[model samples]
Target chain A: MMRRIQSKALLASFSLAAVAGSVIAAAIIYAPEIKPVERPLPTSFDPGEVAKGAQLASIGDCIVCHTADGGRPFAGARALPTPFGTLYSDNITPDEKTGIGNWSFAAFRRAMVNGVARDGSHLYPALPYEHFTHVDDADLRAIYAFLMTRQPVEQVQPKNDLLPGLGFRPLLAGWKLLFLHEGPSTRDPARSAEWNRGKYLVEGLGHCGGCHTPRNILGGEERSSDLSGGIAEGWIAPALDKSNPSADRWDEASLFDYLTTGIAGGHSAAGGPMGPVAEGLSTVNDADVQAIAVYIASRMKPESALQKAASTVATLPRDVASQDPASSKSTIAHPATDTLFAGACGGCHMPGAPMQVTGRPPLSAVSDLRMTNPRNAIQAVLQGVAPPSGRGPAMPGFADILTDQQIADLLGYARAHFTDASPWPDLTAEVSAIRKEDAR
Target chain B: MTVSLIVNGQRRTVSATPDTPLLYVLRDDLELNAAKYGCGLGQCGACTVHLDGKAVFSCLTPIGATQERQVTTLEGLGTQAQPGILQQAFIDEQAAQCGYCIAGMIMRAQSLLDRNPAPSDAEIRRHMQPNLCRCGTHHRIIRAIKRASAVLGSQNGKGDAS
Candidate 1:
C-alpha cells in the first residue's frame, strides 16, 4: 500500500513539471493582444507634436521601406528581400481597414520595441526593433501622433514569403529572446549634449548599425563590431571609421555634406540604400544634422582627422591628369581596354574631362577603386549612381551595353591608371558574381 | 602637349593639352565641324562620335584617352554631296528641327545599326534613350532608323524579326 502511494506521488510530480514547462513556453512565444481603440481624430493630436513626429519619422526613414514603388506613401507593399524570404511592409497610414488607425499608443510602442503586432503575433526583426528599442517613450509617442494623423489609404499588405516552417510566427519569439535588448541605450556623460543627442538618434531612429555593422548567421548585428562596415541592399556600406578604405578621411563638414546632399566631394557619394537616408536627412533641422555629423565624424576616426575640415572640392586626380605627360604608361598592354575606356568612361573619368572641372572626384580618389574588394567599384560601373529624387538623372548604368569581360578589362585599366592599389584579382569572375547577386 | 588619334580612317596628330576634350580637338584643332558642343556634361549627346567603332561623347572624352583609337565624326560618314545610308535615311525622313542634335543622333543611330542591323521599335527607342533631341523630333528619328535598317537588311539579304 505504501509503494502504491509513492508511485502515485511521483506521477503527480511529473505532471506538475510538464504543466510548468508548457506555461513557460507559452509565455516566451506569446504576447497578450492589446485592445484596438477607435481611430482617433486627427485634431486630437497637438500640431507641434505632429510636426516633431514628422521630423522623427523622416529620420526613421519609415516611408522608404513602408511605401511600395509608385504607391501611396505609408500604404505599404514594399517587398524587403531577406535570406529567409521576401517580407512586404505594413501600411502605417491611418486607414481603419488596412493600417494602424485603430492601434493604441501602447500597441505601436509594443510593435516598435518588441517586434510584436497589435494582434499579439511576433513581427520579423527586419523591422529593426533592435534599434527602435533605444528610442524613448516620449519620442515614440510623437511618432505615433504623426502616424495617427496621416491620410488613410485602404491598401492591404501582401503576405510575407518566408521560408517554409519559418513562416510560423512563433519561431520569432526565440530570435527575440536571443537578440532583442529592450530599453534605451545609456547616455555617455563624458560626451557633449549634441553628441549625446546624435548617439540617441543614430542608435535609435537612424539605425546606422543595421547596415553599417556586420550581421551574424542569424542576421543579428554583431554588436562587438558596430559600424565597421556591412552590406545593405547588395552594396557595401563602407566602414565609417579609420578602417574606411576611402583615400581621404571624413571631417564633420564633409560628413554633413554627404549626409545632407548625398555626396561629399573628395570622399564618397551616398548610393544604393544610403541615398534615401541622405534625402530624408536633408529635410531634418540643420542643427540636428550638424550634431549627427559631429558625432559620426568623431565615431569614424576618433582622432585629429575630425578636427581638420575636409576640402569640399575634389582636385587631386584633375591635377594629376593635367600634369600627367603620358597616360599611355599603363603597365598593362591592353589596347582593347584602352579604346573601350576612352569611348565609355573617358568622357567623365579622364583627367581633363569636364566632369573633373565640375569638381566631380576622380576615380583614383574614390574608395571603391582603392578597396581590397572591388565589388563596389564594379557595382558603380554596372549600376551607376542614381539620384535620390526626381531632380536629375545620375551616372548612366552600363550593364545593358558593356559585357562582363569588357567591364573587367576597363576596370583593370582604370585601377592601373587611377590607383596604386593592387589590381582586382579575377575581376571578370567578381563582376559576374555581383551581377548574379544583383539579379537575384 | 601633343596627342594622336585616327580620324576618318586617317592618322592625325595635333598639338594641344593632352587633357583637352576630344570635342575641342576635333572642332578647334582638326577643324571637323560635324560634332557640336551642347551640354559638355555628357547629358546631351550633341557631341556624339564613334571612337574605336563605338558611339561616345566627344565632349567628355579627353584627347589623352583617345590615343590609338579610331575617331569618326559625322564628317567622316559622308560629305554633303554623298551621304552614308543612315545619313540619307535621316535626310529623307527630315528628322531634325533646330538641327543641333542631328549630328549626335546620326552617330548614335549608326552605332545601333552596326550592332543590330534590324531592330524593333522598342529596341530602337531604348538604344536612342541616352541621346536627347530637345526639338521633339524623336518620332522622325525613329522612322529614319527603321528606314535605314530595312534598306541594310535587304542589301545584306538577311531578314530580322522587327
Candidate 2:
C-alpha cells in the first residue's frame, strides 16, 4: 500500500509540472518580450525649445493627420487609406485613459524612430514615421511637450481594418526591419550649413519625398530615383531634381517667390498637392528658403544654361521683323483694321483697365491666343465671353457687333501681335460646331 | 452671451453662447465671409485672422475670450482700390486660385511682415508653415511674401495698417 501511494504522488507531481510547462510556453508564444527603453531627459526645460518644436510640428503638419475632420484638435481620428486597408490615426492627446497620456519619453521616441508602439507592436508606415526618424531628439521632445499641453479627449479611434491574412502583425516586424532607420545620420560636415538645413527639412519635416518621390507597389518610396516626381491623388508633384524642364525656366528669385506666394510669372502656378507645401513653406523662415534654394541649385546641371541664354534674347515682332511693316501694303492694310479695332474695342480692352464685361477673359494673358489651339479664343469672340458668377457682368454679344470675317481678322491680329505662335485651324466651322453643340 | 469687440477699427457686438468659436461669430454673425470654415478644428489655416495684430486660428478662438479685443478680417486689410501691401503683392504675383484659404494666408503673412520687415526664407516658411493649402501653390506664395517684403522694405517703413 505504501509503494502504490508513493507512485500516485510521483504521477501527481509529473502532471502539475506538465501543466506549468504548457502555461509557460503559451505565455511566451502569445506575449513576446518587449525590451525596456530609457531616454535621457534634458537637464532644463526651455520654453523656447517648446516654441521651436511647435513651429516644427506645424511645418510637418502633424495636426492635419492627428485631428479628425470635425473633431477636437489632436484627438486623432483621421482615416488613412492604404493598399492593405484603412488605418485611423490614434489619439496622441494626453488622455491617460484613452490616449498616449502615460507614455514615457523613451516610448514616444521609439514610436517616432522605430515605428514600434508602446506595447511593442509594429506600426504601419502610414504614420510616416519613416520620415519622422530623421527628426532630432530635442525637436522630438519639444513636440512631445507641446502635445502634452493640448487638451486630451476620451475618444478612442476605431481599430484598423486590415486584410485577414495581413493581420498577423509579426510580418510588420520584418517590414520595419527593412525600411525604417533610427535617427538622423551623422552629416558630412563639409557641406554648408544651408545645404544641410535644406536636406534636413526636405528629408524630415518637409517630407518632400513623401509626395514628390514615386513609390513602389508596397507604397515604399523608390530610393533609387529620389525626387523624380510622382502622381499623387490626381495631381503630379513635378520632379524637383535637376532634369526638370521648368526648373531652368524659373530663376532662384522666381523659385523663392513661388515657394512663398504660390505664383511665378511666365512659368506656372502652384496647385493641388504643391499648394499645401507652399502654404507650409510660406510660414517658414527666409533663411530656410534660401537654404532650400541653395541645395536645389547645387543639384542642377549646367545643361540648362543654353535654355536660360535663349530666353534672354527677345523674340518679339520688333526683333523678328526688322522693316517697318508700314512699308508693305499688307502691313499698311493691318493699320486700317487696327483703326476699326481701336474705335470699337479700345474703350475697355486696353491694358490696365478692369475687364468690365463678364465671361470675357483678360485679353492680356489669355492663353487661348498663345496656346497651340486657337479654337477657344475664336469661340470666345464669336459667342462673346459669358462672365462667371461672382466675378462681374458678361461681355455683350459680339455676334451682332461684327461680321464673321471681321471677327476672324481681329483674331488673326490679336494672335500675331500677342503671341509667338501662328494662327491655329480656321474657327468658322468650329464656331458653328460649338454653337450647335451648345444648342444640343 | 453678448460679446462686444473691436473689429477692423470699429466697435461691434455679437451674441453667441460662450463656447461658440470666434470663427462662427465672424462668419455667421458679422457676415465677414473671408474667413472660411475649412477643417473646423485649426488643422487648416483657412480660418486664420488677426487678433490684436497676432495671427490666430479663428476656428479655435473662443467667442468669450474675444471680448473687447481687436479683431481684423481680410476685408479689413484692404480693398481693390486701395489694397494693403501684402494684398497688392498677392495680386501682382497672382497668388490665389480657388482663393478659399487666401485670406488666412494673407493674414498670416501680414502678421509675419508686421513683426519682421525682411524675414528670411526660413523665417517665412517657419511662420507660414501652419497654414495648409491643398492647391500646392507654395512656390508662388513664398514669392509673393518676398515680393511684399521688398515692397514694404522700400516703403517708408509704415507697417501693415490692418
Candidate 3:
C-alpha cells in the first residue's frame, strides 16, 4: 500500500512538469520583444519639413499601396500579391484607433528601417523596408510628421492569411537575418558626390534594384548582379547597369532626353514599369539627373563601343533594284517604288509621326530603325500605319492596297535607308499568328 | 456635414458625409483637380496634398476631420502666370507624362524641398518612393527634384507664399 502511494506521487510530479514545459514553450512561441514608442503631438511640428516629407513620400510612391483602389488614402487595405501570399498594407493615417496615430518617431524609423512593427511583429518584405533602410532619419521624421498630420481613417486592413509554415512570424526573423542589411554607410570619399548620390538613390529609396536587379531562387535580390535587369509582372525592367549593350551606344544627351520626356530620338520609349519611373524622375532636379547620367555613363562597357562601331560600318544600299529579285531588268521597279514611298509613307514615317491617339506610339525616329529587333518596323510596314487607338491618327494603314511582297520590299528599303541592320526575317507566319491572336 | 477650410489660401466650404474622403471632396466638390484619384486607398502618392502646410494623402483625410484646417492643392502651389519653383523645375525637366500623377508628385516634392533644401539623391528617392508613376521616369523625377532643390537653395526664402 505504501509503494502504490509513492508511485501516484511520482505520476503527479511528472504531469505538473509536463504542463509547465508546455506553458514555457507556448510563451516562447508567441511572445516577441515589443519596444515602447514615443508619440508625437500634432501641435509640435514643422510645417515646411512636413511638406517636404510629403513630397518625398510621393516620389517613393507611398500612396500606391497605402491607399486601396477607390478607398481612402493611407487607410491601408491594399492587397499586394506576392509569391508567399497576399499581404495587406496597414493603415498609416494618424488615427488613434486603427491608424499609426500613436507611433513614435523612433518606432516609425524602426518600421521603415528594420521592418519591425510597433507590436514587435515582423512586417512582410513587401513593405520594402529593405530599400527604406537606406533612408535618412530626417526624411523619416518628415514622413512621420506628414503621416501624423493627415486625416486618420478607421479602416483596419485584413490579416495576411499565409500558408502554414510561412504564416509563422519567426520565419521572417530568419529571413531578415539572411537578407536585411543596415542602412547606407558613408560614401566613398574618392567617388564624385554625384556618383555617390546616384548610388545611394539607386540602391536605396529609388529601389531600382528591387525591380531592375534580378532576384535569386530564394526571391532575395541578387546583390552581386546589380541593375542587370529582371522581369516583374510580365514586364521586363531593362538593365540599368553601365554594361548594358544599348547604353554605350546612347549619348548622355539622348539618355537625358529619354529620362526627361520618356522619348529619346531612337532607342526606346518608356513603357511598362519604366513609364512611371520616368514620370517621377522628370520631377527631379537637373543636378540629380546629371548625377544619374554621370553614373550611367561611367557604367558603359566595351560592348557599347562594339555596337557603335558595328552601327557605323553597316550602310544601306541606296538602290533597291540592285538587290531586288524581280527587278533584274527593270530600273523602274526601284525608282517606281521610291516614288510610291515618297508619296505615301515619307511624310510621316520617315521623319516620325506625331502620335494623335492615346497610347499610340510614335513612328520610328532614325534611331528606332537601327534597333536589333525589326519586329516593330516590320509590323508597321505590313499593317501600313494606323493611328494608335486611343491617341491620334497621325498615320493610316495601307495594308489593303499593298501586297505582301511590296510590304516586304518596303521593309527592306527602310532597313537599307534608315539603318545598317540586316533585313528582318520572313514574318509571314508570325503576322498570321498575330492576326489570329488579335481576332481572339 | 459641412466643413469650413482654407484651400490654396482661399476660404471654402464643403458639404459631404462625415466619412467622405477629402480627396473626393477636393476633386469633386471643390474642383481642385491637382490631387488625383489614383488608388482610392493611400498607397499611391497621386492624391497627396497639404493640410495646414504639411503633406498628407488627401484621399485618406475626411472632410469632417479637416475643419478649420488650411489645405493647399497643387493649383495653390503656383499657376501658369507664376508657377512655383518646383513646378517650374518639373516642367523644365519635362517631368510629366500622362500628367495623371504630376500634381501629387509636385506636392510631394514641394514638401521635401520645404524640409530639406538640399537633400541627397537617396533622401530624395526615399522620400519619393511612395509616389508611383507607371511610366518609370523615376530617374528623371529624381533629377527634377534635385533641380528644384538647387533652385530653391539659391533663392533666399522668397517663395514661401503660404
Instruction: Give me the candidate number with maximum TM-score.
Output: 1
TM-score of each prediction: 0.74, 0.48, 0.51
The candidate scoring highest on lDDT is 1
Report the lDDT tens digits of candidate 3 across residue range A1-440.
99999999999999999999777655544434455544467677889878777766755667767888668988999887666767899999988678888787877888889888877788788787778899888878888888888887999999886766787776676667677887673586887898787666556666767777888766677778878877554344667765453554555555666665565544445544455566666665666666665555555544345345446423322323224323332224344444344333543443322231233322323333454544444444433332211122323233333444555555555555544456567645544444443233
Supply the global lDDT for candidate 1: 0.82
DockQ of each: 0.09, 0.02, 0.01
Q: Give, for candidate 3 chain A, the lowest lDDT window spanning 10 residues.
A: A385-394
Error of 2 at A103 (Å): 1.9
Name the TM-score of candidate 2: 0.48
What is candidate 1's lDDT per residue for A184-229, written digit by digit as tens?
9779899899888988888898888889899999888888888889
User: What ranges in model 1 sit over 4 Å off?
Assistant: A1-21, A308-336, A389-393, B1-162
DockQ measured for candidate 2: 0.02
Q: Report fnat for all candidates as fractions from 0 to 1.
A: 0.05, 0.00, 0.00
